[model samples]
Target: MSKRKKHNLQWIKETLELKEDHNWKSQPGTRIFVAGRGALRFDVPQDWHFEPDTKSFRFLDKKPPNDDCRLEASFNLLPPGEWADFPLVHLLKQVVRDDERNPIEQGEIIRLKRQTARIVWTQFKFIDPQENREAYSRICIGLGSGVQCLITFDYWVDDAERLTPVWDTVMESLVLGLYIRDPRTGLAFPD
Candidate 1:
């Protein structure tokens, strides 16, 4: 018959370790979790994969027989006085306005529910360098399709640092997973 399915326990274990090492904090009233060290965080039913050499973490959601999503947050440690010189708010705006890449509208929020979560779409932008340029906009699509919600979280970078690039990559990755063409083909793990 069929071979045993390989479980991603290793990835899960590593993610826990990383979370502990960073003393990650969970946002109040939200399923999202964040590690301030590298501004690392991901949605629920998701896990993390760490690459020590690269000092990066990949947040992956592997729900079998349905959908999957991956968001990677990498750390590029800068010297005491050298950091990505870019405004985080500006980058957020760019991501949201890039409608061609992401279907986010300005000042629009949609509430959605999936089989896994009840998400709220709230626009946010913060100018914390340690956190770098951070922004999000779009529907809080989760749980099932019936309760899918839409929200906008557009933001941009105020500085001219390379952090925006990293943010862009992570955002694209997450969006792609959320809007997969076929759920059957979107499974990140086996049943």
Candidate 2:
């Protein structure tokens, strides 16, 4: 087993801001493999398919063992000082301002572990007019050193309560690597 790094724990905790009832006791979601370097580990209820190529996890309502949930997460490595160019507040508003998107709730969330960092939270309608399905999405973006991680949890409007917990689990269990691997040498992440 590849050893998980502990140095990023503070950033994870600050971004998550978990609630009281969260299952913090080693709850494993579905195991999804990421090609090339590392893998993402999290536990989703069951029957959810994670497509690594697209970096999307989805389970359709019409499908078998239907979970009626759709979740997607992406990590974008930003250029040095890129985060400063696009502040979290501006990003939050931009999401709701364009494409006729309406936000049910949106704001900046507290970074419990870091006073300097910013995390934005937004809930909006993700409409697919072609499919006639309008899903409710909860997005949280955590700005980190040269990295911007976006975790989106969406489900059919009626299934929000049932599927929200799955999203919560992903947020609580998420662990991203801090180091870049060097095939010629070994592991590298500056201390």
Candidate 3:
């Protein structure tokens, strides 16, 4: 593996505290692989189509009919105290309002559960688009005395029952990475 891949693998292992016997292999698709501590492993389908501009991972389930999901991850580089200017809760509320393409109903926000971690509490939504079809999104923002990080996870499911565990694990792993501090002078990851 190349240095980037090797570094990601090691980072995942150490961050997630994976055991030696844990299976860590690439999944089918564009080789868009993600492995964290424990048995957490997932990949987007190679054949599934998506646009690079969206910076998202798309997948299609072969066994089902028109079943799919798109997951997008991005880092927001804010100045030390900039994040606090816009509260995490307000940021999410504004995103839902600004993006009419995905309107989150008031009931969805009321149903969201707040989860507190070392420096983050997530507000999540799992709404059924129509009978038997579901879509979910979670926005997690971490706060330090002077630093904050935001991570979002979105998934569409034909059945809501299959959504909980996978979504939970993925979001948890992403939050775990927030504990690592960047010492660089750049606002975001150095290109």
Candidate 4:
């Protein structure tokens, strides 16, 4: 068999094995991300597909290579302190500062407070050079209950019509589920 890359785009689907992993478990419109001390819950449209990776949990509205319309969530298990201890804007500012991309726009910070739980939120739209197109992303950092959960979503301009509602659903539905215990072990996690 020839080792040539298909059409120079660098993928030969039918001739490739294509995986180290591909796993997902879904019910309706929700998915749970569990960490050592806590868990995060968010809305992932039931119609979308899930991709497994070692670094983070990835969900997409379409298949790979077409995965520009996607969401990425990272569970930060090692936060320095509890949410109430830090000045909200300061923490959020650090997050926005760490990004290397030049964002074209920024939105107001949304602080989601549930009793004592707090999740700081904001979004930015920028052009992703790797994607070679203008893309928008919503970033929310849930800072409370001794944990930090970051969720970022990116979608190309062309797919906004189909992807916007999915974004709204996620934004409204994302919540930090703190210390929900498992039935058997009784550790912190969702059932």
Quote each prediction's TM-score.
0.28, 0.57, 0.43, 0.68
Candidate 2 segments exceeding 4 Å error: 1-43, 54-67, 82-86, 101-118, 125-134, 180-191
Clashing pairs in 2: 28-43, 29-42, 29-43, 29-44, 30-43, 30-44
Candidate with better lDDT, 3 vs 4? 4
The CA lDDT of each predicted structure is: 0.31, 0.51, 0.38, 0.63
> Ten-residue segment with the worst summed lDDT in candidate 2?
1-10
Per-residue lDDT tens digits of candidate 4, residues 1-191? Answer: 00112232332223224233423333466554443434566667766676545546678766765555768777765555544766766777777777787888887888777644577777777888765677777777776555567777777777778787776676666656456453234344333
Model 1 per-residue lDDT tens digits across residues 83-181:
123333344455456544333224544333323333333343433343453333232222221222222222343321423333333333222112322
Note each model's CA RMSD in angstroms: 18.4, 11.6, 11.1, 9.2
Best by lDDT: 4
lDDT of 3 by residue, 9-96 (tens): 2111232444455433433323333321111123444554432223222233332234454443333334544433445566656766
Q: Assess the local accuracy of residue 65 in candidate 2 as a C-alpha lDDT between 0 and 100.
A: 42
* Native-to-model Cα distance after best TM-score fit, residue 94 in candidate 1, in Å: 2.2
